[model samples]
Target: MDVNRRNEMKKVIVSVKLRDILIGILIFNICIVIFSLIVVGVNKGNRQLKYGNTENKQIEHNNSKVDLDLKKEKDTILNKKIDSCINLYLTREKRIVKLDLEQYVLGVVSAEMPANFNIEALKAQAVAARTYAVCHTKHLVGGGCSLNANADICDSVHCQAYISQEKRMKTWPKKERAELYNKVKEAVESTRGQVLSYDGELVMNPYYFATSSGKTENSEEVFKESKPYLKSVESPGEEVAPKYKTQFKFSNANFTTVMNSQFKGLNLNSNIIKDKINILERSQGGSIKQIKIGNITTTGKMIRKLFGLPSANFTISFESTNIVFNCKGYGHGVGMSQWGAGVMAREGKKYDEILRHYYSGIEIKTLNYK
Candidate 1:
């Protein structure tokens, strides 16, 4: 009778174990189903875009059906990468040194300023960007440029970060492949997110300094490497270039003439605007003559219109450079030049050449996702 009791107890335990196993399988299936449904719903939704301001939520567009199919393919094959993107970014010393592929792409892509940009350029930028994303999945654990994860300033300012612009514009300059790749890769690898606020909102990219006349205004002003004040460092070497005639030297008459009309294109009093320009001189080291409301402060020469910011603040300093006013590059003279890159790309050069022109001596590597 005891032996019978033992056998019966064993049978009961086996049944309970089987029941637990079956329950576990059911729960797993349910989770999978729910997860799959959520994914489908999300895929169906359009990717919303917000520009300089978000009060007005503007959706750039929804991708094509073909694009969606590709996304699906990528989603299936690289779900691991996508999941990694959703995970919390890792940081060290308050810098976002670590990011998944998606976050990396987000950081770099968001930094681009491609307004009515080129398809080929977009593809090229994406291809180069993706290569870095895949390569530096885990190893890109540190940032070098303007990035403070907690500050929301990561990759925003001093860093060559992504800004919203047209993809088609990238093709205009025509840069090489290697150079383009390097530039994009450098930005992705070095930038970290900051947590600062600008205009009551977060400052996405915050570090900005001008390199007027090719010297960081501060660097040249502080270090008088040249005999004359007007001289500037031309090539990337220690020696200073010869000083040239400055536009500031307007035969005293022309100075007064341009000064009167320099702020001419716009409707602003030269006298009132002159006051603002004077402030930038003591404040910015660059001598100023023309000042306009709503001028993009970064790239002083380019009217805010080209950047799509019709109303911007910009102060143009008429510094002495014997060279013609017709310019080669764009922007605040502090960071990367897409125009320069485009020129190189158009010339059938590599991305590396483009990167070297903009940034100096930055290493490229791939980080593991694990």
Candidate 2:
């Protein structure tokens, strides 16, 4: 072959090989991009399948539907009215401070009942606390705190137990403080301005306590005052309460000494303590109404107060070395039982229904004070 022609053929071959190499490289780059797109699409699908629908369904099942916009608007108007009208006297601080009524209700509900209780139970407590506050407020009823005449209501449990936001935050577990507080806030705000009333008047005493011995007492039996709304009623399903049943053991000497101290001239002897102690009368609700000890006849309420018993619904038994007082329920057993309310809530009862059940013939009324 001639030298020039051979050189031209070699250059053409080299150009063709370079073109083939460039086409192969382009195909490889296209494949890489396609694989990356497929990988990203798969990951996105997996994430949606794993998290999105499941989380939404869980939320829907766990929480009742709430209209956040409506709640916020109502809260704003309520807050303004309460800020102008309500004030509380803190016994510990010994000062009267003005606060929103709903805020005070939140504190009382949180302090008075377990925050972990069902939402309905908390709502019942919120309404009862609000009614108590309204009935006692000097601004509304001219009834001021008995302890301090300068204030509408006192913070102590004598009125209602209250804990400030700062103290509540400190008291609840760090991991759960915010969530628990939100639960309580929801309960208080959801039932805002609702109170218990009988015959167009705020119920004078919407009393409540920790637990009941299967039934609540008539007001006449416990408080010596007859309240039509506070009549005895069967309160069931409270066996799960922590204080449902309790025992306090007292040595014979200790029991005798305490009894003598409370009722003078009794001269109760340790050996004859069991013989001298006699239960004379019991209320319809199963709490001791009157008892005879030695030569003295005393009311069960007085004995309960003197010995620091949980309730008057107690049975006395003589042991070998100690006198055992087996008590059923906590508190006076005269009003709504908190544990009973919780059980009702879990059984799907609404807050208003629970309140009506406890306070006979009472109406749940919305406050119109502005």
Please give the RMSD to the true structure for each candidate, in Å: 24.1, 24.6
Please provide, for model 1 over 183-208, each residue's C-alpha lDDT reduced to its tens digit, 9 standing for 90 to 100.
44444344322112212221112222
- Residue-level lDDT for 296 in candidate 2: 96
Cα miss at 80, model 2 (Å)? 16
Worst 10 residues of 1 by lDDT: 237-246
Model 2 C-alpha lDDT per residue in residues 102-208, reported as the tens digit of each score:
88898898899999999999999999999888767775556688888888888887888998888988988999999999999999999989888776566778999
Query: Which has the greatest TM-score?
Result: 2
In candidate 1 the C-alpha lDDT for residue 125 amounts to 43
Quantify all predictions' global Cα lDDT against the true fold. 0.36, 0.86
Candidate 1 residue runs with Cα over 4 Å from true position = 1-99, 103-111, 115-330
Q: Report clashes for each candidate as comma-separated counts.
A: 84, 0
**lDDT for position 356 in model 1:** 38
